[model samples]
Target: MIIESKVIQGKKLIFNFRSAKKEDASNLSVLRLKIDEETEFLDREPGENFLSPLDFEKLIYEDSISEKNIFLVAEIDDKLVGFARLQGNNLSRFRHKAEFGICILKDYWGFGIGNSMLESILMVADSNGIEKVSLYVVETNTKAIELYEKYGFKREGLLEKDRIHKDGKYYNTVLMGRLANKLKSQ
Candidate 1:
């Protein structure tokens, strides 16, 4: 389930995008908290993430074996900076779809990492027989919404006050989706 690494050059730095490895568990665990602390666009707050490195290792192992799952990471000089996941349900009725999520260190926000990761996930999803990929984004994340739209994902619905942040404010979440055939038509 390893995707070939693609080297990306941004204005300030360069990085590689590849599938996450078991050896990366510790790094991924720490990076997850760092990125979560850096953005409100993520579902969790700074200290809310409780997944241990062992948990990440287990998840990585599971993803490697399932055609329906994908976990990718962005590495710069061996440092993990960003990651994305496409998680599919094994239930018969839900097998055709997967839930997508992604996060990047705030310092690397505009380096096209998110764009590359989305393309990678979609490509893998298509190959794995996933017909639909869906995700929920904070209503205020216009940049992310624009990126998803560019990739043929359409806004489907809105959940009012779905997330209560550390700032003591309720924010709406926008549900978006992309279909395999839908992208082909586009």
Candidate 2:
């Protein structure tokens, strides 16, 4: 599922969001690590489950051809700054649901990049007949939680002690889901 590139004008900054290209593999490899290390909200540690360039190449290539998946990248001046993915299941039991994930660099926060990514993902999900879109967020991520809720996601449940943060204390995870619908704009 290829998304047409969209140029979003934030309050000040402007950036492009588009389908991940094969050449973006190396940058996506590094972007993932930087985002994970910069924030504890994501599940992975900096180097855990690290995917090399070749690994990303393969994954992106596969995602490029998969009808049930989409990998979108956000860029400014040709530099990758963030990414999001919507992964749908092929099995009959879970074909109507998809999982969504997004990561933006700290420098790019507060620029409506997340809103664009999410709107695009939901568009794809709705077009594909994906009735349910789900995501997991750290319980402490109030800003993100608010954004999800603003977009119609409802808290489904909580996973207690789901993550052990840098402070050596366990934190809960919020499971959220939204039924697919037309894209909403702010």
Residues 118-147, candidate 1, lDDT per residue (tens digit)? 999999988989999999999999999999
Query: Against the true structure, whose lDDT is highest?
Result: 2
Residue-level lDDT for 182 in candidate 2 = 45
| Collision pairs in model 1 | none
Per-residue accuracy of model 2 over 1-186 as CA lDDT, tens digit each: 787898889758999989998899999999999998999899998999999999988878888888879999999999999999999998899998999899999999989999999988988888888888999999999999999999899999999998898799999999999986643331
Residue 73 of model 2: what lDDT? 96
Counting clashing residue pairs in each candidate, in order, gives 0, 0
